[model samples]
Target: MNMNKKELPSLLLLPGLLCNERLWQNQVNNLVDICQPFVADFSQDDSIEAMARRVLDRAPEQFFLAGLSMGGYVAFEIMRQAPERVTRLALFDTMARLDEPERAATRKGLLRLAEEGRFIGVTPRLLPNLIHKDKLNTPVADEVMKMAAELGKEVFLKQQTAILNRSDSIPTLSKIKQPTIIVVGEDDKLTPPEESVNMAKAIPNAQLHRIPKCGHLPPLEYPQLTTELLRDWILQEA
Candidate 1:
């Protein structure tokens, strides 16, 4: 028993900053019967490299990997660290470049606010960027704020720091040889769809999918379609 692990199509999912297992709830529930699914813990780590290593240490010998936003950054780091272990890749609502100066400045401001215990400035205001404007008053909006609140300030700071420290992954985009898919929300203002286009263009044999009426958090904003895209991507190579 100690020498043998179960043989299954292991799908290891790494969630974005401030996102716990709840982030991949829909995918986890839907894919469990089809494969061995695992949601990674990134809250304890302050660096993307550490997060990648942690996932590698705990993941199956070889698995399909999907990550959203900051998790996408971690996914790139994973490829840089251990490309041999990732059988396929799905990058959703993410970019491969370093943050713009203004974006970095915004992150610093949020870090300062978190350090001063002023989380209110970050949520509702930051929430809109995470979802479509028309859904501003919906329960989905409330859920996003609630999740961030529960994750608290420390995790936020760690995540922000990790983003700040992330190098330009653009240089490595062409190197990914796995079965890759770049999915973005048509209305995603944060990472935007253009960046996803660029990623898909750079990666060999990578496919791009855009979720309609969706924003940055595609998995939660459009669960049904998100799950469908993932299922299709998984089956493409199977």
Candidate 2:
């Protein structure tokens, strides 16, 4: 390990459903100078509480925290569980609310498919909801699908169950005291920019950034831009 790396703050990154460290590969590689990046494994746990506990158990005493989509839900749980242990918070393409009726129905449908052993991760039909139209045929889409495929069906079932049963985090937003940043893609269909807008409004002193021509997965859709956003947030003064 580099001596400078040991001196930097640890950035604990949480990936969304059907995602792994690959989702944060760019951030981890690019932010090495400013922070030690650690991507939490959400594969073992089936509930947000358990997932948050897993992260807290492995996390440094005090670290910067960031989560995307389903990972954002776990971040909220982490804040609820150990806010004092966190130095900063960053949420990307996520919301503070529980699954709406329509969204719940969609998740249930997918869950049913997986249960019947018909799980096809990130299919061509679902690419539009997960990435920008321009990224549909690009390497970005391939990376997203690869992450989903590698995680496989069992992890998908666990992640979806956790997402479906996650708590409503709206009330917990105002209690966040750490310097926070909320980011969303302008064309994100899954969570939308408005969700990030509301989160920014709720968390005191939280900053919100909207990336144009992006979708649900900004870290993959716009890795450099995401890295820079995270760099600025991590380097922000007290």
Candidate 3:
């Protein structure tokens, strides 16, 4: 789709767990000319499905959508509700299956920590798992920490609870007909490259791209690669 200067598609971006609007600022800066992007407030709703509905309610009549981690879960629900309204889709560092038993235990533990006012303790430990090991002591780490702090304990718990109970969407992926892009960080221990690969395989037309030397949050750690992949995917879809 070679859109003229004024014919760009609007994009709805979803942030991950314990994240805020800052996560997608780099993406917006990089794609503003080709896409008008809006960040979804997934923190407001308690359930993944409800959050998806709320986001879709405020989205353009039809638009391109991209989501990361927890956001991907909500995006899948949005796709389920309004497949026709979506012109293209992007899923990054996320999974299609619901939380597994071990993962649920992990989420439950995190929630318990949050409920006990130990959210700060959890953040330090959790943040490292979301970014590259080398970035653990850098400015990027500070930025992730800042975003998590900005999200606050109350909202973090809500996001975690919503994720714990999110529905399985693997079966629904194949039903989607829009152009799709699935990206993963080669070092992403949280979602893992295998999970993202499986999702790409399930979605008939999805293209999978893995970023090297990065972890779960590629937009923050490797903004240029993320933007390039997304821009290319958007151009291909058009």
Question: Best lDDT goes to which candidate?
Answer: 2
Query: After superposition, which runs of candidate 1 have C-alpha atoms over 4 Å from their true positions?
Result: 1-5
TM-scores of the candidates are 0.94, 0.97, 0.94
Compared with the true structure, all predictions reach lDDT values of 0.86, 0.93, 0.86
Tens-digit per-residue lDDT, 1-238, candidate 2: 2234668899999999999999999999999888889999999989999999999888888899999999999999999999999999999999999878998999999999999999999888899999999999999989989999999999999999999999999999999999999999999999989889999999999999999999999999999999999999999896
Off by over 4 Å in 3: 1-6
Stretches of candidate 2 above 4 Å error?
1-5
Candidate number with greatest TM-score: 2
**What tens digits encode model 3's per-residue C-alpha lDDT throughout 97-208?**
9877997998899889889988883356776688988888787888898987777888888888899888899889889889999999999999999999999888987889
Of the two candidates 2 and 3, the one with more favorable TM-score, higher being better, is 2
Count clashes in each candidate, considering only residues at least 3 apart in sequence or on different chains: 0, 0, 1
lDDT of 1 at 226: 83
lDDT of 1 at 141: 79
Candidate 2, after superposition: displacement of residue 67 in Å?
A: 0.4
Output the worst ten-in-a-row residue range by lDDT, candidate 3: 1-10
lDDT, residue 136, candidate 3: 85
Tell me how far candidate 3 lies from the true structure as C-alpha RMSD in angstroms: 2.8
